[model samples]
Target: MIYQTAESINDGRAFLKIDEFIKNNSVYVKIENMNPGGSIKIKTAIALVDAAEKNLDLKNKKHVIESSSGNLGIALSIICAARKYNFTCIVDKNTLPHTIKVMKAYGAEVIIIETPHPERGYLGARLDYIKKRLVSDNSLVWTNQYESSANREAHARLTARELLNEFPVIDYLFIAAGTTGTLMGCVQTVTEATPATKIIAVDTKGSVIFGTPSAPRYIPGMGASVLPPLFDSKNLFDMVQVSEKETVQTCRLFARRYGFLVGGSTGTVLTAIRDYSPKIPAGSVVVMISPDGGERYIDTIYSDEWCLQKGLLQLQSSTSRNTFSGAVVE
Candidate 1:
């Protein structure tokens, strides 16, 4: 018999039963939202901070800068505060006030970009600000989560190990991609350990990470306008994309059925599992990664008013799976 407990938020292990939610006996979800910082971003944030400390970079650096307005910003703020390092977050208007407040509450300085880039929008503007900051100060260290190998390595070493310990023979694993760090890291470790496990990368419909055409993405967390360097086509056994509308519906479904209010990206992962479950082998152990809880999204994804304004309210309450395209199943 095996039992799981999160002794500390940093334990990097917590799973919830998906039997009630998915109606699938073999499916389970690792709840990464249970982490101390309220998301799996802490895993990589700690890695980046520790790496800086190891090389004496943190000693001379007066501040740490990151181009994030969501989970990563909050995670880094918490970690940096504990280590006595000043942290700055570059955000845009699209970022939720709740996220910015949380980061600021942890002593992080928030810089909001008033103008959006013509092509890439706020994401591009945030990156441009980071570049300017780097040029202005030599003591500011930037932990570029998108291209940082440490980001992927942290999930490979910590998050994947915890899952593998619980289910050594996992048959299928589904993960939502943002920076692609979590997806790439989990795939590297899980595939190497359980050679037959099928790894699936889930992304938002507007995200270009999986070669989908770029479009305006209202949803945050799972999609990237720019393809993250950590993304490897050959590493994944399958891929899936969920639209913003479908993602909202999945979040509502989980809330209604299982009382689990997950983040937008988690909804995307669950949507993929429901769509692909038909082709999955019987009695196969499947794990879907839930990146964060939904409390932080109350003002955006979970708000009835916001949903209505974005035309997502009409899509709610329907949990039916949609036909998938632009996906590779192997």
Candidate 2:
């Protein structure tokens, strides 16, 4: 079974229950959005903050800077605010406005990067901006999530263990690939204990992660334009590349069928599972990690006007019934 965790100080609050819906396979969804910052990035955010607290001197005001699409920024903003640390989040145009508002509400100074870097894309642009900020002010501590060990360790120690405790038998585990922190942690844990469960890494069409050619991906919290340093090929069973169209359709379908409105990353996972359904035997238990909710996607993923403008379809056929085999990255 696949799993992920969140930001709240309390692990109880971070780990939510598994949700089951009527389908061929015994599928369970771990709702991590119920966490304090409404996403599993809270786990990484807290890990980074905890490490910084121990290593960095708190006597002087530390201005924490990081590049994020949305969730991590909000998580860091929440933790930093409570700890009395100044936070500056560098985001890109893909980040939802509602996400920015939440970060600001938690006292985070938000900076938006408009242009994408030719090689690394928006994440590269955000990192370049962070470098300039560091040059201008050495006092700024960059919580580099893309390259941070704490980001992966937190999930290995907490999220994976918690998930194993909850479900000992996980035939198939599906995880969204962004920073690859969560994927690494969960895959390692399950592979060690069970050594048999199939681990599926789901990525968006445009993400450069998994060595796929980089393209434009509007959704945040799912994939990265650059290959994350945290990513390793070890223990990876297969990698699934999902299109944004299917992701949007899956989110809409979930909302309509299960009445659960999930974010883009979660939608990507469900869509991957649907496409991969042909290979999955009936009664095989599958676990999916839902990183965040769809509250911030009101103006985009859930908006007809936005979909039409982007030439995205409003709805598509339900993915519950397998239509095609999911394409696996080489």
Candidate 3:
């Protein structure tokens, strides 16, 4: 029941200035927003849901439950809506309003939970709840992105293939670590297509992916308080942890410099690139992945008041806070 849409590769590069960046730094940025759902999660959504239908009883299932804060949930909601499947998502309290609206608009039941839990965020708790519910009723399918091999397979098959076709001689691949599906898939692709390429896993300071202490993380994706079972550290060359402030600043810089409005996770990769680009040899091709678009954060990171309130972005000295629109040059 895969819904087909016109490919967006034909969309002009005006929104994504990959050409200029490539010309200046021989590095390529793969914009995954070109996908129909406006993120790379579409690959996983299609793969996981299709696999569920094949392996489990999804046709007459009452609901498909999963935990996600952003793009993955939206992707699932869209797919479920198209196929007439009942979709339910459990998300953290801090999720962006736009994401919730999108999920509800697609007719997916939305559940919000409190954040900063002993088991990390809502995902772990939601998984626990789903497990308990499954005990009572075995009809629902739990598409656990964190542990699903299908997630990794999706990236390995689609994203990796696309990257190999786009760049035959990639020297470095940078991706933000979340469920580790994207990173692992890209690693699998690089191993087969460009074995010599280095895979840099970027994480956030608060994410437990590297055993960091729990904190109030502003970024929607990239950092998890727990290491997902799918993450294979052996496949990575190095892991770099970027702070929330760094992620926010980088997102702002990216928007101003490239006019590319991507999510905070994308900022993590860009920050890694800015730090590691100089160390790489001349003319080596480094490809950074932008997982999703910026529309979801219009009321948060993309908002001037929100940035100032959170002390994420500051205006010029002597300029009244009221005049600060997050666009003031530093």
- Candidate lDDT scores, in order, read 0.79, 0.81, 0.76
- Give the top-scoring candidate (lDDT): 2
Which pairs of residues collide in model 2?
1-170, 6-43, 7-42
Q: How accurate is candidate 3 locally (lDDT)?
A: 0.76
Tens digits of per-residue lDDT for model 1 on 1-330?
Answer: 111112244664578877744444457888887687788888888877776666548857858899885899988998888778899999877677988999999999999998877766667778988999899888899888878888899889888988898888888899888888888888889888888988988988877888877777777776877778898979788899888877887776677667888889888888899888888866778888888998888787777678767866563333334311211111
Query: Sorted on lDDT, highest at the top, how do the candidates line up?
Result: 2, 1, 3
Candidate 2: C-alpha lDDT? 0.81
Q: Candidate 2 residues 259-291, lDDT tens each? A: 788899998998898888788887887888888
lDDT, residue 125, model 2: 95
Best by TM-score: 1
Clashing pairs in model 3, backbone N/Cα/C closer than 3 A: 208-224
Instruction: Give a tens-digit lDDT track for model 3, residues 177-280.
Output: 99999999889878877778888999888678876776667668677866699988887888888876666776766676667787888877877777776677
What TM-score against the true fold does each predicted structure earn?
A: 0.90, 0.89, 0.89
- Pick out the ten consecutive residues of candidate 1 with the lowest summed lDDT: 321-330
Q: Could you tell me how far off, in angstroms, the CA of residue 143 lies in candidate 3 after the best superposition?
A: 1.1
